[model samples]
Target: MSKLFNWYSGLGLATKQFIYLFIVTLFLVMVLAYRNLSEAEALLKNQVIRDAELLVGRTNQYIDASLDNVENMLLLLSTRYDLFEDGNEAIAADTLRKFADYNNSIAKTLYLVRTDGKVYANEQVNYDIIGNPMLPELYKLALENYGAINVSEPYYSTMSGHTLAYVLPVTDARRQLQGVVVAEVNLDSLTERIAPMIYQSYALMTRDGNIINRLDSRDKMLPYQAGAYPPVLQESFREQLEAVKIGVSRIEGNHHEMLAVVKSTTNRLGWSLAAFIEEDYFYQGLQQLNNNYRTASVVWMIILLLSAYLLSRSFTKPIRRFVEKMDRLHDVQIVAKLPVTRKDEIGRLTQSYNDMLERIQTLLHKTKSAEEQKKEYELKMLRSQIAPHFLYNTLACISSLAKQQRIDEVRDTIRSLVKLLAFSFDKQSEYVSIEEELEGLRMYMHIQQVRYGEQYTYELDVDPSLLQYRILKLTLQPLVENALFHGISPRNGGLITIKGKLEHGVIRLYVRDNGIGISRTEARKALHDQFEQERSKYRFTGIGLRNVHDRIRIHHGVPYGLRIGSTPGVGTVIRVGIPVLTENDERLGIMG
Candidate 1:
């Protein structure tokens, strides 16, 4: 079994699929053929039985009607008033002759025998029946019966070759026997009466098993022969025949097989009828049906083989294309997207593959760009390092020269400018103590004050308790510069103020300026312009404001950012919100 599995596994996918399909098709065909043949045989057998039962029922009705006709005739003869009362023998004879004349097909001859055993014909003339021993025996039997009707078994007579007799006794109202009336019926008349109702071969048999009369399929008579059939018959090629109310059995003759359906009258006649049909008549069509099934099976197998080949290709072709494309996937080579025409599992797989390739290519490009940018920034930092030290030295020389010349204001201004530039270049300390930030802002504002003189008077009213907390370096310096330039530069004497406080676990810082205050609309435009690449209408360094806003948000999240509010001809206030923290906070000394 393991070797067989290995062999099958070694075969190609299409070959395996075709083998499975072929096996399934063969099994289905065999099962269908078997079931169809079985059902056909069953249906044929049932139809034959039903047809046989129907024919037997019709034959029973015809035979029973004939028996009834004979019984009615006997009753009519027995009921004659003169025959029962022994009054007017001529009238009784006339009544019998008229009855025979009217029903010649049923009663061929009618006669009467007195209780004394004297026989008189329907002609009213007495015959010497004692001289004939056979006639005397019939009268003697009638006398013994006395009052009841009796029918004789089939017999041959010199007058009527083959005949059956009906003997009815005459009795008065007191049930006293008078005479016996006998009616001789010709068997040929029975055949003529039943001729039109028979469409198949039939035999009428007496209780003693003698075949009284036989009729062919055409209802024509065959020669009379004595053939006894018992209440039951055993045959080699047929089902057992028994004296049932109705029965059907098969019979194999010398040359052909036949199916026989039997029904017994079980009446005064002591007769039964059996109908026969040839067995080959039903099986001939079954042979033709088998040939048709064989032809159809061959044709269907051929079609299934062809269909299996095509269906197998439909499955394997797409998979082959996917494998080939995957084989060509490499770092330097770009694989083309597969075309998806169906919404099946294979189509989804193709789509997923294409998306995966695109993400891989995008990450590759981003990695290369990040590497290049890292190198450029490293080079710029090294090149810019020497200039800040040189500027510091120059500022120191100017400060020393001004102090010797007793120019205290110029000396202080140059020193303040040097401190601001040094602090701006301090990249190592991204966060500084709030006190340090305030000190730096004081220095920068002092330089602006020296330049602008009394035109810009600023106040710093920060909560003293918040002076030790850490804040982002250079955050407040840019906002202060914008207020001086964009708010105060346009007016002669403007006030700039800085206020800080701790509220609701947050630090609120506000920078306000009272000058030629911008309108609310203009303030909104200024804030929006800060985020743009270009400067605002006042040519202020909006980039500085945008930088401070972005740094605060990036470090503390969007919840804390710069907010601007102002009114026309009124002071403009810029507020900044940040989570309040003490010296022990984890983020106190961290770089922004």
Candidate 2:
């Protein structure tokens, strides 16, 4: 089954739908047809039994009417004095002769007999029995029965073949038994009378279970005994028969089945009528119905399979077109919109592709502009690195003399200037350790201290752990230079504080001065001096500040940069925030 499914799935969409629809339609039609046929069979069987019951009833009525006419004639004649009075033998014989001739269709012969079992008058075929005893046992029963009519069991008669005799006793007004009148009912003639009542085979049975006349010759010789039916249907048949005097029932056999109905005669005939049909014989029309159903199903399956193929093609055609277009889209900007436009999922996808093309063009233009700006900034940094060499040579000469003369202040000042000049000339690396940056700031402050005497003082308070962390060079020295010149130069006693700490995974360094502070507007200009058209108009020239800001922004993103806060009467604090990075970060961490 799995292999069959794999083979089915490998087929094209149209072919697969065709096969699936065909199989499903066939299965559904077969299931429905089976159910319909089963129901039809049940209905047909019930109709057959109903028809058989009606036939048995009609046959029973016909036989009862005939028997009633015969019995009424016997009763009328038995009470008559003209036929049975004393010294009326010849009249009785003539009367019997006329009665037999007129009712010859029902009764084959009629006879008059004495209660002593002697035949007195014989109507037909009675020449040999004129002086002999006639049906002695039956006549004795009639005598013992007195005035009531008595019916003998079926017997084979020489004159009339198989027949049943009805005997009525003749008596005086006091009910004394005088004689008996006998009428032999011919079974062959009775069968002929009821032959037109039903089309199916039928049988007439006596109360003692005798087979009087069987319409089906095949079953005529088979004697019906007690519990004669198959065991599967015996109990049901007996139950049906016992529930009602006349009803229809089904009887199943090992290789065959039958529908039979029984009806008892209303008149005193002491007989019942039944009709039956075999299953195969009854269901011949159903076989024709099944053939017609199968033929129609085949035709419809073909029609539906063709329709399914067309529908599957219609459903997949658009998807095929979309795939072809996508295969040819080598360049996003040059691609055109799809020609087919319907507001479905495919339409939305086409629109999204068009939007993607526009975004790509915009991103490419911005990327080219950023590349040009980066080259210009590199050129500017190179030009700024070419500083004056004469200042460095002179500071080296002064530092050697101050050390030989033992002038501590002059020697310290020249040493600080030499260190600052050396740090500025080295242009290979843009990032330096925090410790080197702090050392640079300390050297610049020492020169300021020698220039301003005891009025200028500076202190460094920083976390020792952050000494090895990398920061852009010249970040702190510029801020300290600006504070001493702009902030401390105008004050009598001013102090500078450099603080460094790590907070929330960021390195924060602060350079604050306790001097005559600039206004909020002046501090804002100092931070944004690069954007101002006239840069020299601000008190702070901002060359060093802008360089530090640009370097920090170029290395980190815009979020990590320098910020300034100042009040009119209070000092200014410049804070630099950058991601913490050390020499070990190259191997173990992601740097901003």
Candidate 3:
């Protein structure tokens, strides 16, 4: 059983078990009935077909054997032509008699004919056929196909009664053609030869579809015309004769249907023997098979019913034990635990249920701890925004005076430095407004201007409407520092542009500089290269570029981080795409 099956069984729902067992029982019953019927039908049909085909093959073999024998006889007799041609009456008569005696089984009466229309026989018959176009059809067949033996339609010979013959071209001792030799075959003997093939119900038939012999005949019976076969025999036997000339024809006798296997003869003989089997009798055995099948089905169903009853009884104890365990586990002070056993389908199921309960308890503890950590990070962001704005304004004016070579302005510059440092170190918090972050940037800009002494210029194009947008605490401070440090060069001290605007609820910021430009290759390397060997070998510092990139990744995620683009002798532009947030998003806060 899979874990799912065992798990369902262990469940406390009684209705679920009843549904599953009922469905399984109905399905197995239907399948058993369907399979048994289909298999039985195929077996019965295949047996009938095989029997019919086997008889057909036997018939084909018998016909081939007869054809072979008569051909050999024709070849041997065609050599004795001198006695007949020289008009040696005694020798010719004796030769014909001997030929008749030796091939008595197939030959009926020996006769001879010359091309000049003379017919002679060893003995005489009721009809005198001396000069009456004697055997004109035989002669015609011989003219068409000379030197080869032939089988002809049943006909009466003038000197010999009913007969068939094998005709060949006769040659003299000098090997000159003399006349033709006809070896007669008795028509009655054909039926006699096929007598043994006549089985119980069916009789042997000739090629013309006549009943030639019967299995129960006492004396040799002459072939007789079939008045009519039963409807079954006529239809079935005709079809078998037409299609599978070797097998039992579907023939009907009286009211019962019979399947007859028929064989055609060899030696070009026109006889066919067939055996019939009564289909009605064979089908009678099915009633007995059905009775046995019904008994077996009832017995099997009863056995399964008994097994189900025993299984329900055995399951009662395990059900009671499992319920008792659950009842104890429900008590306020009791703990639910499962006993361990070696891995097996049922044992593993019990262990899995216990493991799931432990996992749920651990998850609760982790959720509480994470909530605390979020508050701490939030406070850190607020601290970075709160400090450094107004104090730098005072220090900016004082530093300008001191730069004039006015020694008297020293005291004023010291006082402003004190105020700037105080605002720069304000209390820690998380989310801050953009206006607050901008205020800190203004202060930092003043300090840089005083240090650069008219060589650096800072331009801020921050939209006033977007000042209310919430931003992460130190988001803009690093970007300002980046523009001041790496963004400025000697020829152009620094012309840094800090622009911020809102587009579709997202804050868009940019820091552009008119400094010695970073190459496009350098910009790509700065973003991707981690190992020193992979970075640009050219002497260049990427401290501010690297820092701003890392800070954006840490705050927003890898995708919404800094985008750097530059050209070799042009300037570099750094862009930031960040989400505008609210104070509930404590990771982005304004100064309090």
Candidate 4:
């Protein structure tokens, strides 16, 4: 007993009680409920049988009304004259339109068949023969019996598509066959009508009894059981037809063996309309009620757990407050006044947390200050290196050409070099006008033309108005240098293309190369690592690409950078997306 109590105590007072209720009281309640469920199912079965009988009666009345409507319309067509005339189809159509205005669901237009079995659709001027003439079976039966009635039978129409047609064959004064009046009704109307009568009782089958879903009716009346005529549907069909003849009625579970009342609709065509629900499947209210109970029970269990957690948190609250206070405190000591004065485990925790935060603040200052200085120094190094590196290379190239007796080339190089240096050396502000940037690029491109001697090509397609927009200084030079060094140099001959424009309120600047193309793997690496990973794996390095990525990050925020796409043996394209100013950049405009 003591061991059991200890085990129960370990799970907490609430959970131990929940387990005991689940095993003893819950188990007995479940068994009793199952027995009750059986009794309830039997009771529901009896009630559904009663409900089915009632629904069947209403169903018979509805079907009869629908048939009477179809039959009355057909009878009116028979008494009408000029129906046998050459333009009789038009006359009948006119009659149908008058009826249609009275009831919109009933189309006033009429299709008819001749005494010799010719079918005509609509009385319009463009009447087309639907199919090869066939004898109207319903008309022949009505004529043989001499009964003035509406007949429906299965007939295929090519114009309106193959269908079970409702025909009203009406004769003239001399008992001469005038024509057959026809209406092709949607068959789903009959099937769907009987579907709602029985809950979970649904079936759609033709007169010949073809089941649509994959199931072959596993459990049905013995009469509907597997037999030569497909026993699954036979018994229900018989019961439905009998009910139609003898008022709505429910068949015994032993004979028809169906669960619920069966409803059926037979159009003028004599096609079977039958649907029935199985008894055991009908009453879902109890099952759904039991499920609601279980859901409520689980929800209550979660609520109990949350309540325990909140109770435990009474002790944990002061420690949590101390941690939050420590996080908000920057390079400073935290001295919190204790909220819980209760002599418990938590009050001591609150006192200790305040002491720990006070001690850590003293030693962290020198280390944080040193780290911030190191980042600033690294940024300075990168900034200082860009200008001298370009200037030294440009001046060296001019000097080398001058020594080789190429004074004109040297003079041209120096002139272009001076313009490039002026743009590079300018530190008026962090941002420069794009017009000045383009001027720098043109000078650089001229120097390349002098040295490479048509080996390199450059094109600048930029919006004229966007020239006054502010752009990061020296941003375009690295990209242009990359096109020369990494792209075109990779192959013996190539083309370089540069295009820039403002699209949809953003600047899209692109540089494409037709050279030894970068593979998709290389492009992903360039963008992902900002080309740092590219330097490790491939022969083509990514220094210029990395510099562009860093500058864009420093100017913009995260997520904006170079996107490279290429396929091996094709070429690489670098598209740089940057936010554009909606109006003329006020700062750049003022500086200008």
Candidate 5:
């Protein structure tokens, strides 16, 4: 389960949305389809049972009508004195034959029987009626119910496969029973009369479970037994038949399930008409309906999935574009504005992002301008400090040389001073090539050498490749001057070694002097612009270590600035760190 959750969490927003929508839709569709199918199946079963019941009812009515007709004919014949009189036996037989012929659809034959058990049938006998096993009981029933109609239980005969005897006793005018007129009802003929109403297989059975007429020929005139016929014709179904005049049930049959409906006829025969329908046949239409519903549901699900995919894409497309833009934010000079293509939340987010970029650009422009002004002011201050102080000292040195009458020394000192002034006064740019700055440093050192005279020596050890790279003007000169006056001059002699190198992506320029070095506390103060007042008087210019540090920080950022290291009575090293940039690189902009 945790793994499933992790997998799901890793999916993109669009895929997650699609999965969520599909799952919910699938659940709803399944539930709705199941409910609908269940109801439809129930309704279909009810319809099948209702149809079976209707068929049984109609067939039962037809059977009852046929029985009534045969009974009526027997009653009409019972009133004929010719059928009961002894001398009118021929007339009775001829009358019976004609009556049987007229109602042959229901009656198989007619009989005139005496109380002594003699039988006269309308047709020549295929079987002896006097010797028939049912004759005594039927005759006794006719005698006991004198002048009333009587119906015998079904019996098999050679002439009629299955037959029921409808007996009507004939009496004299004074109500004396002479004989009984019997109409042998062919159950098969009765079944044929109502066959049109019996759509499925059926049976016409007596109240005692005798099947008088059935579509199955093997079961004629046999008592209904479980499993002998359809499995539904069992004891339970028989009990149900007795309980209700019209009823239906579903029961398992021999080959398949069956829908059975039993309807008892409202006649003296007390017979039941049961119709059997195969469950598969009954629900065939419903099965087709179910198949169609399933097909349609699958198609609908496909369409829903497609729609979910499209909807998810529609929502996530803008967010993907927004993320791409954010990735390039720091890599580009200007932040690009995203287009607001909609009035929805994503569009509002895009609008907000564009607004933020505009604000950032404005802040950066203002910051850059302010930093440039600060650097310009610091440069002016450095120039101010250099002009009067250095000019006075150089003029004094030249005057002393002239007073000594050293013409060659005077000419060299004046030429070096002129070169130093030219380098300092030039204001074409605040940044200059390393080679140019080094040349200016050489001129300044020359003037200092004339003043101190053989006290200190200087060395420039720089990578030739670094000469074309740009640095702030007078950046190295202030440090060199501090080394000269504070270190070399104080000791009356020292070696000032100026070194420049490239390390990693930055330029490292170091100035070292083998003279009396300041303590850690004094070095920290000097770098932070907290130098003592006494030391300030000896400084060559107001552009000290602190001024140079601030200029580097303001222009190139805080990481690129001066680091000071010193120990008392040993050498002091001031290392200047700045990004490496050539004359062609953009100054005051992003480093190339």
Candidate 6:
């Protein structure tokens, strides 16, 4: 809104600059921090996934090796054909008991079952080989895969909490189907042998998703399903588990996210081994890294903000000083120059301002000198005019009148001459009111009219309101004299008109004469005082038209000066322009 813009504009320059710098820098810092954090997270997540995969893969290898070892042991024992011979039941039983006792960590029990319904075990027990619930499926599996070791899925056994049956069929010399030597493995013990030291949780499951054993419990025999284990191994990860034979995946858990790695055993068991860890737990270092990054970013932002503020202040400090100095510069008398302390734009501006002040002071001194000279010149011209033909003519007229006893006419003519001399010599001020200048002009014209009676006539037309306006002393008298001598005098007699008016803040004075006018080239040359050398012999006053023009320009500036309009054989009109300066107005200095 306009209000917000106005408010911002009203703020100090330094404050606004600070805001601009800080906002831009803050945006860039945030973007960089976000990018760095994202990259770190991606790298950390990848490391966690690789770690999970390595852990699960190693555990799977251990389980497969253990199963392979058990199978090899059973196959070695099957080579002992004497255990299945007609008279070697005691020996076979003793052999089986020793084997079970020696490898008790893996094998819980050993059984020797014959096709003839004879069943023997490591422990003394009476059992029907065909009727034992745990043995029948294993027996059929052994027979179908004859001469090769076979393993069954985990099953519950009363004696052992969870057990797997490894069976190897015994054959005769004729390759006849005899009985099977069975080993009941404690699944819990086997899983413990393959447990990894760094895993949070691990499980072994059958191809049909049956839970064989888990690290959390020794008696976990339920089918694998949701809620049976950690949520990492639940339905969210089940799809990935079935899709890949060995790989790692990220999945959502109950409260957080987790990484799960699943790998299937390479042996005949075809069991999958999986290990999982929470993302937060696995990448705890990454979390700490993120925290450190955030802390550093905050500190950097604070530093940047402070730096921006200081820089903005430093940049605007000089400008503010310049403005203050400018505000104090109310008059030429009190003007002060600013110091240049740097080579920047502000410093350059200061230098320029100082140069301007010097130029103004120089011009003021020159204008004052010129005004004094002009006043002195006017007085000199008036004193010199006393010895001229005008004085002779006036004296002769007085002498002629005295012989005729015209005493009143002689007194008036002498009084008018004295008044004219006194007005020109008055040194009261360089500038005088328009009315005073016009009064002086009237005195000068009265003397000329007395000498050239009936030869020329003069008229005055000036606005009353403009008479109070001030102008340079003796400014108009020279122009009127120039018209009288150059234009009117050449024709022996002519009518002269002096007009004054206020036009657009300027005081314009026109002196018109219906006399033999000079050419335009002569007018231009006369205004520049080029014709003064030729006309000096006949001119009454040394103050020429060009002196009037120069004085006006120096006081009022170039825009307000004299302009000439003339027509040969017709008339000449010279206009003088000057600004209306009242008593309260300061004398014009430099325009700027």
Output the number of the lDDT-best candidate: 5
Residue 504 lDDT in model 2?
91
Report the C-alpha lDDT of model 6 over 383-463, residue by residue, as the tens digit. Answer: 554336655676676677678877886677678778876776677767889898888777777667666776878899999
Q: RMSD, each candidate, Å?
A: 46.6, 48.4, 38.2, 22.5, 50.2, 47.9
Better of 1 and 4 by TM-score: 1
> Model 4, stretches more than 4 Å misplaced?
1-397, 400-406, 528-530, 533-543, 582-592
TM-score of 2: 0.41
Candidate No. with top TM-score = 2
Which 10 consecutive residues of model 4 have the lowest summed lDDT? 533-542
Better of 3 and 6 by lDDT: 6
Of candidates 5 and 2, the better by lDDT: 5
- On residues 353-428, what C-alpha lDDT tens digit does candidate 5 reach at each position? 8887788788888888877877685755555556465677779889999999999999999998888777877878
Give the alpha carbon lDDT tens digit for every residue of 1-592 in model 2: 9999899889986787777776887789889888978787888877876776777777788888888878987987787644555587777778878787788889877777765544545453354544333467667767667678888877766656678888888887787766778888877888887877764566576776555773343442222334543211234443443343566554542244444544555446567766656666567889898888888888877787777676566645677787888888887656676664868776777777667767887787777766676566556555654234434544555666576785876667777877876876677666779999888877766655554467889889999999998887777876786777667667866889999998998999998998778787777877664443232222211336766776677667788888988876688899999888876773454458
Q: What TM-score would every model get versus the actual structure?
A: 0.36, 0.41, 0.33, 0.36, 0.40, 0.39
lDDT of candidates 1 onward, in order = 0.67, 0.69, 0.58, 0.59, 0.75, 0.73
Lowest-lDDT window of 10 residues in candidate 2? 532-541
lDDT tens digits, residues 184-207, model 1? 776778776654544355666777
lDDT, model 4, position 515: 75
Candidate 4 local lDDT, 1-592, one digit each (tens) = 9998788879965465556654655456557666765687677766775676577556556655765666676677667746656756556567665654443343323466677665554534434533434335644654653535544443444433233445655677887767666655433355455556644554433445554212234444424555453224466564454444322344455364544445455544444434455654656677886676677665755665555455544634566665786576564544444454656666677566556655666557655765675466436535543444455566677788878999888878888877666666666766777777778778877876665567777788888888867776666766766666667776855677878898876677888877777777677777454455322122111245766665665456455657787777777778887766422564545322
Question: Which TM-score value belongs to model 5?
Answer: 0.40
Q: Name the lDDT of candidate 2.
A: 0.69
